[model samples]
Target: MSGEFHLSVVIPNRNRAHSLARAVLSVRDDDAGAEIIVVDDCSDEDLSAEYSQLQAMGVRVLQQDSRRRGGAARNRGVREAGGTHVSFLDSDDVWLPGRHDRIRRFYAAPGRDRTVLVSGALLHIDGDIRRPHQPDWRPGRSLVEYCYRDGGRVQTSMLSLPAGIARAHPFDEDLRVNQDTDLAMRMDRAGIAFHIDPEPGVTKEESPRPDRLTTGAETADLSFAWYRRESGDWSPAARSGYFLQDRVWRLADSGRRPAAFAALARSLVPPVSPRETARRALSMIAGEGLYSRLRAGWRQRAPAPADPGLIAAGERWRDLDARARAFCATARDAAAGQPGTIQ
Candidate 1:
């Protein structure tokens, strides 16, 4: 709207057209004066109409022909952005209408600087909004230290970075799933401070998108690669840390029991939580195999029925389990009909 915008919202999208529209709309409503860029990663979906639609609404849609990953798309958007602060939105995620205004205030608060990366809580959904997982992230620590200490996640949608620092470190294009984590890790290793806005910002709809998860595995590989860049190698200790803790669950879901077991073993060293160790061991023993077990668990109804508050911010794991199952049914069906579907 003016000569210079305070924030540039970068959204990377694939085929999730409807969701993208809703996300862009939310941003526009909240941060009307901020610059918006929709980076299309060559999705087959007819987003031209959507692009035209957003452009009419004052959003800048950038087309990226080569589909590398979310990291690459985000990097391109940040590189092309013309704002002092950059925020990201995934194609399938939506932001609360007031998220931008709130975030801007958080960034402009006393003591805020370009060196601090801001992140907040993420609410997951599956046609129904799930409760926010109060991520115990502290503002004073470096991002890597946060990871080591709390094992928290920094979703791209809920994070805002200063343009100068964002330019210094771009998202890892090679990583599709965990690039955000990798970038935060890189930033942490480099002594950049991260500030967590104590509020939920992005809502993610989680379903069993196997390719997305496999893309996540590729991301894990790239994350390990990024770690190698920082720490010389994925230290057996570090590998067993948060990164492999996640991979063990994935491998378990993929039915790679032995590998998952090995990973679980690898993850059981110092700094590993006893609860997490037990959880991984039990997961391996249960023969849960990802979706099947998840669906089996999710099929059960919630003891406390969905209420307005529950829908907006419910933490009942049972409720989440049920919703995940419902969502996974469609995903499992989609994966079943399609061969070579990464699960």
Candidate 2:
């Protein structure tokens, strides 16, 4: 294995042990000498068997005695990572094939350095619905503006940066939600360069776990607070867009209609973009289900261009999904004293 740019894949897992193996398998590359670390956030269930399986596959597992959430777990992983570049993957999400090659290519390119943070598009899967999330950032646009005003997004699973930079700028541990956004904002403010790869690199499965942080009722409140904390350095238009579109939309989705309306009213103080705000308000009024279908339909009209890399990634994801289901079924059968052969 060449030592030009060793990659460390850090996966922060809580209680999602069933899917953790698949996540680990997605990024493991013995030939490339990629380091894989799984940081456990004080899971309630017994994970000894899972840890043993991961350890057998050469994954280094670390468990926290207390629950510190994903940010802290990720920080611990970064601190423990020994590679030149570090990439993160959630336990429920899996990186598609060619992600490591993409990272290595980015790092090997001329004019790239440790201060560069690389991200790629993600294939977000929610049940029968699948969509590709690609950021539309351009020159002279701040990360905040791209995210708020232009509908650009960057998830943790799609992020890869230098270990030194990640250690220097750790995630905000106290944040209950939107940690990815907060970290990106801080990195942008600190003059870290961002590079986005057009290829879809990860398959981010929307886990049905009810205790997931984003599904909690307090997500709106936490997101609103996060917006207020980070929007101070943003432009008025960015602020308005974030408040009216992001925060208010989240609030309405969480059934906080009164608070959402109040926030929408507040976003019109200087009237940055009345049309955008009105559109968001109308979307909220139309209900999430209808709006989601409409948005999906709109996206379907202009589908992403077909790429061989993306097509291979999707094929790999389906294979991994099948393997994960088979593994889970076998485990369950084993626990029930039945024949546990994986067919």
Best by lDDT: 2
CA lDDT of every candidate: 0.64, 0.74
Candidate 1, residues 146-217: lDDT per residue as tens digits?
A: 554355667677678778888898986766456777787777778777767666676665654665645344
Q: What would you estimate as the lDDT of candidate 2?
A: 0.74
lDDT of 1: 0.64
TM-score of 2: 0.82
Clashing pairs counted in every model: 1, 0
Q: After superposition, how far is residue 237 of candidate 2 from its true place, in Å?
A: 1.5
User: Clashing pairs in model 2?
Assistant: none
